[model samples]
Each structure stands twice: as structure tokens, then as C-alpha cells.
Target: MPMRPPFFALSATLVLLLSIPAQACTLWAAAGPDAGGGTLLSKNRDWAPDHVQILKYERPFGGHVFFGLYAEGNNDPGIKNGINEKGLSIVSASASSIPKKMRAHQPGKRGVIRTILSRYASVDELAADADRVFSGARANFYLVSDRSKVLLAEVGLDGKFSYRVVDKGVQTHTNHYLDPKLAEFNVSIGQSSSTRQARINELLTQSPRPFTTEKFAAISRDRNDGPDNSLWRNGKQHTVASWIVHSPASGPQKLRVVLANPDQPEALHEYTLDEAFWKKN
Candidate 1:
């Protein structure tokens, strides 16, 4: 018998990135044959339970019309994660493994994520502007995807960066660096990072094929590591929101968002990337 990739397992690993402590997030993406002939981009936004978050939309002057998760009352340049009209989507997590002292400047110092979401339409375009976009930026690991490709990027506080295209299998990231050069500076504070990373991957490998948003949502709610360190965190830093974006090889993309707080029950919202939806939102 030929080997078949555990489809849902790849998406399950994406939720693991959200379990790390501090104001961190979990991000993962799956594409090609392993992704059930479509692409799945997922994230669990971990932060203080008190911080309010909302879905933000924008039609930047001449750039892509897009929307993403944002802290309420914030007037930031970009969103936590979102997909543009061109079908490009980006999600991120802190590169906590890289110490602060080594940072040439604050991570997201130049608001790179916002710029890319507002202007670029694909990983290839982002790559073409790599020099202009990342030259002086600080830390963060970004996962970019379009209808057919997925790319993982690590931006160091020292102004260094690396990116790899994940053309197959499921790829994931937590609050650590996976790039060899960046990993050398790894000084992760606790086991939360490594443990979550492992747990998510384990879930992905054991899961059945043909991924679905519901399955990924189940992974995001995982409390296998207890409240503090499970994929669905409940310690000082907890999950505020979760997102799952399904981009198929053909057809309009779709999104599902779950907003939550330790003090309240979760609220779910869904959207289809169609002309009417964009016009209405």
C-alpha cells in the first residue's frame, strides 16, 4: 500500500502554536495533496483574557481589500491574520526563542505584516520585496499562503531573516525559531514552546484524512497540557480568538473565527470570500 499523509494531523499541529505562554499565537498550514487537495491555514491567538479583540476590515487606498483579527481600540497598520481579495493570507507568532538583547530593534518594528497584507498578493510578490520589507524589521515568524502555495518566514530581531516554501506536508510554528541560523540564538524561557509544538504535531499525525474546519477547531480547543499549556490556553495568557482559512485550488475561499475569553463563552462567525460578502463587510 502507498503511504498517505495524515490530512487532519497537519491542521491539528497548527493549533499547537497557540498554546505557548505570553502574548503568543499558534500558526500552521497545509497544502498540495496532503491537504485534501486544498489549503488550510489556521491560528489560535493567545493573549491576556482581558484584551478585547475584533474582526477588522479595510480597503486601503489602492491596495488589496482585506480583513483580519485585531485588538479592539487599536489603530494598527495590519491585522493579526487575514486574507486579501487576491486570495493571499498571512498569520504569525512571536519568535520568542530569540532573546531580547540580540534584537536590533523591536519585533514588527516597521509593521511589516501590515504592509504585506495591504500591498502584496502572493508569496512570490512578498519574496520579490524581501529586501525592502525585512531589511530593518525585528522578530516574528510569518506564514504566507495563496490558493496553491505556503511559505514560512522567520524574521530575527538582529535584522536577519529566512523563508522556506512548504510545497508538501503540514508545517507549524510556535514561539520559537525553526531556521538553523536563527535557532542558534534560541533561548526559549520554558518548556511550553517545545511541548506545544510536539503536542500539535502528534495530533496531526494521529488524525484522519480530508481536513475540515470543525476538526481544526477541535484541535484548537485541545487542553491536553492542562489550562496553562494546552492548545486552548487558560492561564494568565489565554486564547482570545481562533481562525481557520480554507483556500481551495478552485472556488472562493472561506473563513471561520471563534472569539473567546475565560470569563465568557465563545462566539463563532463565518464568512465566504465573495463579492457580496466583501461589499457588505
Candidate 2:
């Protein structure tokens, strides 16, 4: 059942992070025996609709192609969640509160994904030089996936980033730091969810036989399933966008993507990896 660990890793991570107001974006990734043995990633972006758009670009060096969910007219590491031609998908969730220490005395305060995408091609490449790459960087959170593996990269304000392979079964994270050491600086109210993460965890652990995109959608679209929380919240904390990306077993260009905006049916905007890369500007 382990198909889309990294994809759904974005799913779980995003779901748990996008908690309240414009202060959150949830992400999740699931693989191993529970993900239908395929890599699936999903995200729920909660923000002002006017600021979000799906963007595409040609790699500077390789000139292959890549795409990401980003703010309009933004390319300076503008991707909130996106995938590259190598089937590398990256999604990031902002912290409601970053410890003051994580900030570096560098130029760009936060642009980690774009920096990696601009230089290397895969999560392995980024991981190899994580220390050197993230030097003079601020705190950042992301779920990035390559062809064969998924990773949860947490860069704390202390100027250190940790990457963990979520290819095991399933993994989820929110804006709040889960590391006991990092939690010391976490002043978030409830970004760390017990009910929401638990529901996703249970579904990933004990769902029926084969896991399908529909099943994942159902869980994501579930409004009342959370005993202590809800995925599709209302008021200033409602969903701004929801999307799913699945990498094929053969190649990375033909990534399958389905996206919905404001939690409603999709309006047919460009999202598929191949189509996005082909997009003009």
C-alpha cells in the first residue's frame, strides 16, 4: 500500500499545519504498505485567494522544467508547494512563530526551496550538502519528495536543518516544532494537533485494503471527522486550496495532479507537472 509516501507526506504535514487564520498551511506524506505502494503527496493551503497561483519555470542550468504553488508574480523562491522534472515535489508550511535564534545574519531571510531547486535536482543532492546549502539561512519547514524517497526537512531558527525519510509508512507535521529541543521556542497555540494527525494516522494505518485517490480525498474533505479538530475549518481558518500530486513509477514528467481551490471543485487551472513545465512564464 506504500505508493505515495512523499506526496501524502505533504498531505499529512500540510493538513496538520494549516490550522487557523492565514497563519497555517497543512501538509502530509504517506508511503510504505499504506500508500498503495505509490508515492502520493497532498496539501491544504489556507490563505487569501488573491495571493496564490500555480507557477512554472524552466530550470536555469539544466533547462528541464519545474512547477510550484506560489504567490502571484513571484519567482524568488516563490513556491509554496511544487514538483520538478525529476519527480521532485516540494511543499512548505510557514511557522506561526519562529524562534528568534533560527534567523541567520544572511541576505535572504527565507528562500530555502528556491535555493535548492536552483542548484541541485533531487532531495539527495540537497541532503548531501544540507549544512553547506542552508548556511546563512533562516528557519523553514518543508516536505520534499524525489523519485524513490520522501523527506520532512525542518530547518530551525538555530540555523540547522534536519531531513528525515518518510518512506517508512506515514508521517505528519505542523507549524509547531515536534522536536523537544525545538519546542522550547514554539509559542504556537494549537498547531500541534492530536485529533487531526490522529485521524490521518488511523486512516493510513487501518483503512481498508487498497488506498485510492478518492479515499485520500474523502479523508481530506472530511469536515466533521476530527474528534478534536476539523480539516475544512470555517471563518478565518478555512481552506484556501487543496491539491494532490502523484508521481508515476516510470518517469517524473508525467506527474498526475488534481487541485481544488477554496475547497470547491477545481476550475481547471494548470497543475499537472508536465503541463506546468510547458506553461509560458
Error of 1 at 127 (Å): 2.3
lDDT of 1 by residue, 1-281 (tens): 67534323335344353344446688878887767766888998887765567787888898888888877643322367878888889888867664433343464466566688889988778888887777666677888888778888888754678888766688888888877777654655457677788888988888887677778889888899977677888786788889999888888888999999555678899989888777865
For candidate 1, the per-residue lDDT at 61 reads: 91
Which candidate tops lDDT? Answer: 1
lDDT of 2 at 82: 65
Cα RMSD for candidates in order: 9.7, 9.2
Q: Write the per-residue lDDT of candidate 2 for residues 1-281, one digit (tens) a residue.
A: 55423322344444544343434556776664455565667666655434445545645665446666665642222566666666677777765454222232435555766666656677677678777765545675677766556777766654656667756455666565666656643544353343455555666666674555556666666566432256644445555566666654444333334444443565435344555455556
Worst 10 residues of 1 by lDDT: 6-15
lDDT of 1 at 268: 94
User: Which stretches of candidate 1 lie above 4 Å from their native place?
Assistant: 1-21, 73-78, 100-108
